[model samples]
Target: MSDAVLLLAHGTPNTLGEMAEYLDKVTGGRAVPAEVVEELQHRYALIGLRETAGAEPPPLTKWTLAQGQLLGRLFFDNGLKTKVYVAMRNWHPYIADVVAQMRQDGVTRFRAICLAPQNSRTSVGLYRKATLAAAEGMEVEFVAGWAEHPLLIEAFAEKLRTVWKVACDELGKRVPVLFTAHSVPTRTVTGDAPDPYPIEAKRTAALVAECMKAAGLGEQDWRFAFQSQGVSGGPWIGPTVEETLGVLREEGHRGVVIQPVGFLCDHVEILYDIDIAFRQIADEMGLKLWRAESLNDSPLLTRALAELALGPYTAGVEVAPISARV
Candidate 1:
């Protein structure tokens, strides 16, 4: 194929032993403190451990590849011949390696879509930089963000509806919803490099809530907050999931549903951050918490991605591969 569609994501290590190198790459070769590395090793171990010692395997890479394969099939079903590829930003199958493979395969021009739905300097910006910098002789285009796409909103709304029912049945009453997204350094967004990340995150949350409300759901109350605040510090986004849970507890909310609108699939963030860390905190606060499932291998999400890959991208001029069969 001379043209292809690429899916980019924040990759995870296939096993626990690679945490040091993964952290090194993520920090641009900085020497991550031993304590930090050890802490991360412990966190990764909690996700899943092999029968042997000192090994933890994650399913993010597997799920991401499945997403790509499904998207390729969806394109073929619609009479398109575009190929789909997945590249990791911080681990094996790195962007440069995949670009080299594509070049070797005689693929000329390709459109890249970050697996992240919302755009931010800390996330998609770095991804765009790495991808474009890797493709020296190839035509490259990107779907920077699709936070408010109807299909995407519908996909998330479906998760909410499914989880909301479980929350209601357990709590014996309707509960409030707390929409969330990954927190970035406040400086990057509100400081010098201001971005629409926060706005887009809120827009996604609002759209999902509106979709649910139109379906006669989430009428009790809904609030937006940030999750998985990093150790990079310098004041990340406001009203963290922990803080919000406290507020809900104080407000006498017996239960609350969490919907992470930013992420599209399961990774360390979803696997450990929400499923373990947030859940533990919620239990301590006498609050029941259920996160919306990751959109891994979801047919709706695959269709949404196919739409982006095949849709016309307006960038002062039409982006090539609009036909998706170049």
Candidate 2:
């Protein structure tokens, strides 16, 4: 059977120049001098990815492509004939256009998967609507979230273990673990709106904690934190990871390990917020800070995603395995 997988993402703007402009707008016309932008530029540059200046770049397009290729190889290795396609929202080569391209390419069976591992109405909901709108009359299955996928938990746990070992060696002491994710508006929790953001975030943290515990790390040594509050409002989930670090410093903890459970790749949040911003804060506060590597194109993550795609699909929802993968 000829099938196709549409991996949907929220892309970033293209090019250093374009990014500078976007950030300026996002930051409310603040003068984000070229130097600051250059620092931001270095983050993407480290991964050998660049955005175009004038063009609005799909932030996740490159990531989607990488993931698609991984899935393609996995399918081929498993003796399955499946073509993978990447569709983006809020950027070029949008979901609608990708659907048209897929239709033109003679794609039949279609499976739509949100690149986000967790499910929240704001995040996956928009993608679901876009996918369905693009599908029109086409038959498509959507996989919303896989918060508790055993393989995913295992991959993250392993990543944490590796980083923790390094932190121990570098700091010569047991480091505190701070698990973080982007924070959503407090309204998302208090409003009548159905936002699964908090639930999913806590779930991922809990599972990771369980895996870490099994690896001999005690729960008391780790804490769940939130970050990247791009908005100012009533409240957002916290002890903000940054704030948590400050607390740790006040408590005289000199070594800390950060694990970003909310994101799979190193994007602006990880690059700037954690790597640069938090590092500076930690340094000034007389503490050592390190982050576990993101699950960027990891074979383990890819395998977990493949398994999720093959399972039954849902809309604007999260589904996770009860146990961690070995």
Candidate 3:
């Protein structure tokens, strides 16, 4: 495809009944237990029940589709005639199926990027596999792992500063900042090479903290944590956001700001994990809580992501050839 961009993100179930199938794919065909299934169903129910201004809960798939449209507009405005498509790993528009459709459209070569900024064998690595598997004869290039892009950092930093100001104005005190990302299994990220997921998450957090300092706040006011750990009976990464919350409370910080820099859009992890679950804990702890909004196809994020799609390799970057035919 001379002009195409594929945007990928973690897929969510369209309905509660689809949870088992989604989890099955996510867990590599493992049979989820009844209790685990029930818990997932509960979360999906809560996700579907969410509302804003009396409207219905927003579906992640719909939001992702809208993001693709926005990205297409950005690419067009930037003088690149790229057709953008959104595909999910476990949802309706599966990566492989989407690639098949793209081939029918006469597209030959294209660049792709996952919604996850940080590359990990567990996350972006999976996306790369699916993308390559689907491309029958197309030359596929992926712009993966854009964790430290200045514009991307600026986007989150701006949200952080905005939310921090809101909290301080309402509460009459500066709230500590806690940066969070989805916690992966320790086994997947540990070992000699070590996964860079946490490191990338912290890098974004540190940059946001630096921006906050420029806007007037001490370094000690900010820290990082992980969230949305799986319910699987395995050791996952820590210190989790829940643990960090207790620590902040013990340290006498009565209010806090959450910046989930790892996630680029508002999905179950953000809508429920932070907005509902974490808020419940904060209520019990008597702490005012604020979460920075996800970037979500905003102009800043679009510009940053668009630049990745149109790449010059950033010097010393070597992209491996995908599963393609000559």
Candidate 4:
């Protein structure tokens, strides 16, 4: 049986024109003129890290490709005869296109893994639905969530430790650790039931904090914060990372280290939201902000994924269920 691994992600537009076009499509033909698209494209252009210069931003798509290639290498290194495929929920190289390509390539059996570690109706759940819709006739198994994977926790802890060491050496003081993840809608948290997100965020933060404490950092020095709240105000996660910074500044925090615990890579959210937006906010608030490097193409993250993929095959162990909290 020819086996393939299908990786799915939420994609981004590759150019301003494409972005504007997508926005118009999503908005049902609300006119987005070419000039508007061009101006917006410049924002991505200024980043200078797009897959193609003067093209629409392919940040998410590029990350998804990198992740798939990394996983493919891991499988190859371990002597697993598997090919990797990447599909996006939005933008070019759409899930449907990738599914068709996979079918044409003679991939008969498959495993689908959504890049998001945590499970929520909006993120992982949506990916699952989309992937299933795309598969239609393909025989495929799915890995729902790996939020509680041991190696994943270890990788995050390792990242925190690395940042803590730098902070100690540079600032001559232990920087307060702020574990952050992307904020989902408040409705997820309060509407008729508790969202699994806050629980998962707290769990991840706790694991990292536990690892830090094991490395001699104290729990009192760390906190869990949420970031990237959309304009909708039903009740996104809190205290917002930016707001936490403000409160910390008021409470006399000198230097702070931020860990984007939610994201696995340095996408626009990490680049713009935390680096550009929050960094500016910290600066204006007279607070020193240092963010840990993202888990982008990190060896530890790769190893974690490898371990997760090979667990059932090599260790004869079933992957643990997603933790209810964290």
- Top lDDT prediction, candidate number: 1
Assess each prediction's global lDDT (C-alpha) against the native. Answer: 0.83, 0.75, 0.80, 0.73
lDDT for each residue of candidate 4 in 52-149, tens digit (9 for 90 to 100): 44443355666667878888887776567878888877667788889889989988778777777776776777778878888888887777777766
lDDT of 1 by residue, 215-255 (tens): 55654589999988877546887889889899899999988
Q: Which residue pairs show collisions in model 2? A: 11-58, 11-59, 11-60, 12-58, 12-59, 14-51, 14-52, 14-57, 15-51, 15-52
Decide which is better by lDDT, 1 or 3: 1
lDDT of 2 by residue, 1-326 (tens): 32788888776666654667656544446666676677667766653446544343333555567878898888777766778888767656678999999989888668887878778776787899888988887888877777777777788888899889888788776788998888876766676676777778778878988988766678778888889874434577677877898889888789899998888776778877888888888998898888998887888888876766665545333334312211
Q: Give the TM-score of candidate 2.
A: 0.84
Candidate ordering by lDDT (highest first): 1, 3, 2, 4
Best by TM-score: 1
**Sliding window of 10 residues with minimal summed lDDT for model 1:** 314-323
What TM-score does model 1 achieve against the real structure?
0.92
lDDT of 3 by residue, 1-326 (tens): 34688889888776666777888888878888989977767776676732222243246776788788987886666566779988998777899988888898878998888888887889998999989989967998877688877777789988888888998888787788899888899997778889888888788788777767887768888888989988775989999988999999999888999989899888888888999999999989988789988887677787776666666435124322211211
For each candidate, give its TM-score against the true structure.
0.92, 0.84, 0.91, 0.85
TM-score between candidate 4 and the true structure: 0.85
> What clash count goes with each model?
0, 10, 2, 9
